[model samples]
Target: MPSKSSARLAALTVAAACSAATTLVLVSPAHAAAVRIHDVQGTTRTSPYAGQKVTDVAGIVTGVRTYGSSKGFWIQDPNPDDDPATSEGVFVFTSSTPKVGLGDSVTVSGTVSEFVPGGTTSGNQSVTEITKPTVTVLSSGNAVPAATVIDARSVPAAYAPAGDPAANNSVNGLPLQPSTYALDHYESLEGMNVQVADTRVVTATDPYTELWVTVKPRENASRRGGTVYGSYDAQNTGRLQIQSLGRTADFPVANVGDVLEGTTAGPLDYNQFGGYTLVANQLGTLRSAGLERESTEKQKNGELAVATYNVENLDPSDATFEAHASAIVNNLKSPDIVSLEEIQDNNGATDDGTVAADVTVNKLIDAIVAAGGPRYDWRSIDPADDTDGGEPGGNIRQVFLFNPERVSFTDRAGGDATTAVGVQRLRGKAALTVSPGRIDPADTAWKSSRKPLVGEFVFRGRTVIVIANHFNSKGGDQGLTSHYQPPVRSSETQRHQQATLVNAFVKDVLDTQKNADVIALGDINDFEFSGTAQILEGDGELWSAIKSLPRSERYTYDYQGNQQVLDQILVSPSIRRGCDFEYDSVHINSEFHDQISDHDPQVLRFHP
Candidate 1:
């Protein structure tokens, strides 16, 4: 089925592989002389002899991927060529159980091909491979190539290739310079043995049998465990993913700031999920950086504890309610008031028109009570039809759950799901015209988004206006593994608008009462140091409560190897100046694979 162009190219490729570099050998008219493994895999991402046949390519087998669609083995020359612009190793795609062993010295003939993971439409990097290989066992138990040190100096300062839509494949047709860009550096070492040493763990081990570490420290490093993710900077360059797919044991769970004191020897791999990975056979010592899952302490007398949690779209029919309730009771220490986001409708993803989450909230409250927690009363406004964005027909919205045993919801007249709550000054205090009312629901910023829900809660003879929010997610933003150098964040524009509206509401409250105990808390869906969070903390009207903790310990979420903050509780200036606040980013989730929710609930205890 090979076409004329492909067949001719394959014939020439076979001839090149047939020729030996420094040995007398039989030369076939149909075959080019066997070439070095480096000749086929030039410095460029795409091979020089792609679509052509290559034969007699001799090397020692370095790795084997005998499972999944990528069933193949990697081979590398024991002694590399002098030119650094060429790779001495290449993957031979068998597409089935490979006959080669780990240390077999073999000669192979196959068609050189470039395989784009996720297809060409994804715009990810393509893997150069030898397909449909014919192998000749030359020897067995041969020595493998030494692993190249992957220290700070080995990695370039730059993070990604310069181009649009992520990976800039081929660098706009320019020749690759492996020493300049980090992408080029990984490309040059593709399929070769590599080692990383004296690294810090950024992401914990996930169910996929992988973890992330930074071989070199990056800019804006947090004090203890977190990594401050700022604008499109090259901060993630030193980070590398480590997939222990070939390991005989399960990968250990690690928190951020953990140290790996020893060397991890593995072959460099580039795949679809992450960019460059070290497929280590044995991971080094994981030094505990004194970071672990923390249970927040209970509130003190006169201090009302308020918490916010994104339940990851909790529904009445979902099976995670019990676990979530248990976490709230045992880990979060039963806050007096809790802001719950992503509360779906009763049917949950059925696409029906039923938008009411009364059944859903009741079940969660009942579960909490059954799990040895407080008797809770919840409040929220249902979205119009399917206007809210989430799982289709799920109508995920925000809800406020207050412990009636300690606090009460002050509901006023004239409020509905479609009506916006009016802010009024009542007796030298800010009061919502209607309790559990929607905030500017008709605004375009909240179009197809979960509108902010404002509730007035009376605790210990004092009232506080709590605004719960579930802003637009960071789904559309390009990932850190993106190929584009310093990836672009396209979701900030809308989130900025959302933050502005929320900040305006807080300012209105402050105008009514300079010391108004207004706490805007929920899933902000951005980091504490992000522009969105900064905008919400405008002119000292409201301060992010997470900032009360030491920078080294301020994190509620973990992603891509970095302990981060996404859920925050922003309070008024009076609350921060009073300095009687205890904020805890409950570490019950995010780092564990068996988590009921992807996020950890945050509790802020203060005198209101």
Candidate 2:
């Protein structure tokens, strides 16, 4: 004899508890079980578990979105475990909650429910409730002592058993088991906390900002052979400041080539280019610490060296700027003149200021200095008042960084100073002066939006010309209005027009400086097989440095799971020989969508 209202309330509570328990059982046991955002699509079991209750899921907050008047916030869970097939999901709304930013590791519990598609759905599935969502602070711990550092070469290969009895007895002088064994049997220890010790063969340390230490694994250790990761924020140079905890403590620091011990609490986050990165929350010293510096010679004449990178927008933030700058000064193949793209200008800056504000030019200089690159100097043109009508988007653009000691600019062209290039272009070009130079300013055989930045440099007594070009982006077009709009032919038209201009410019360079050593490099925003690229390479005026290699190794960018050649360095035949120009399309940006920029960088090296 219970009242109807009371009975209904009790029934709902029981259903919620049952649902939560069921979800927990279905989720994998390796980590906490939770609902993911990607999976919420259709049915409760199929879609991303919206309007369903889940428990014990762990992940880093990739993104956060808030609605009007403190209605709620959607937390994006980017845990690898939260696959679409699994229930661990996102779109968990919190009512009247504050706000959460990106990169925060959090754990949430709540009823998995569907959000109203366009805010129009019925039933409990429309908006689920998170009765007891809890977030735990997990960034503070003891710094791993420095004595345990290991090197990549010291660790032994992993082995599994082979099925053949006669062959299983011994493999590579080691005892084999009954089943087939893998030489590299290390996979599971990705995101777990562990301590490592080894020698550092390579050290990329930017002064007071970040340090990347690569240690070879110790021999016969239980862990697999690989590199160990260690990093320290410059703001916390003398201490460890865990971003999650918002607290700081005195911690030990280690230098490059220093044998040290350190603890890594989680799995190495692999970059798009197959680099295993360890995000360190704590670092300390061990016994018998010492440094080993090797003497290196400066670049001699006649060496064809060039550097290229995406720069990931080259933002002004301390962490991002330092990380990218360090990589350019250290991690790259070390070119003489670096052609860079995606250099950004602050929204309201009238001039290119310090790296802390206007990152496009100043930050590159700062980063080079931090990486101990004192021999390098650079120059750039700010597009603030350029008559070429400004770039399409008005934020991100391209620039260049060079080593003045190695090559000097004899003539400079392009930029906002004068619209030598047309108005439709985004990034203005420049022609630098160099030794063994071959630039003739009087030549007007080129047609471009933003004029091509061309320059001449001396290498091994031979003069070569370098042209840095950034064509119109495929982001939007005249009639299309916006990217999300349909009827996309307008975008195609603009891209085609941009390509035509680029092709004409390339032809013009070759026509003016016949048989001259020249290279065309930058983000073209077009694939190799596309019409734009074809036109540029028309009549064999330009040849792809990558296509010269095996077909299997020609991709420079990956988008939507499709790999394409967007960024390239095309070399004229004059510099193709004796100057075996090779391109290494760094796979850093395209692999991880979270990379600072959306494009992977292309590097070219020529040995004369």
Which whole-number lDDT from 0 to 100 does residue 113 have in model 2? 47
lDDT of 2 by residue, 95-173 (tens): 4333444454455555654232112211111223243344442321223212112234322232232222353322222
Model 2 scores a C-alpha lDDT of 0.41
Best by TM-score: 1
Candidate 1 residue lDDT tens string, 473-524: 8865655654444555677888899999999988988888887889998988
**lDDT measured at residue 191 in model 2 versus the true structure, 0 to 100:** 22
Residue range with the least summed lDDT across 10 consecutive positions in model 2: 231-240
Q: Tell me the spans in candidate 1 whose CA falls farther than 4 Å from its real position.
A: 1-36, 44-58, 83-85, 107-114, 119-123, 131-139, 156-183, 197-201, 216-234, 247-264, 282-292, 317-319, 413-417, 511-514
**TM agreement with the true structure for every prediction:** 0.83, 0.45
For model 1, where is the 10-residue window of minimal lDDT?
15-24
Return the lDDT, model 1, position 210. Answer: 71
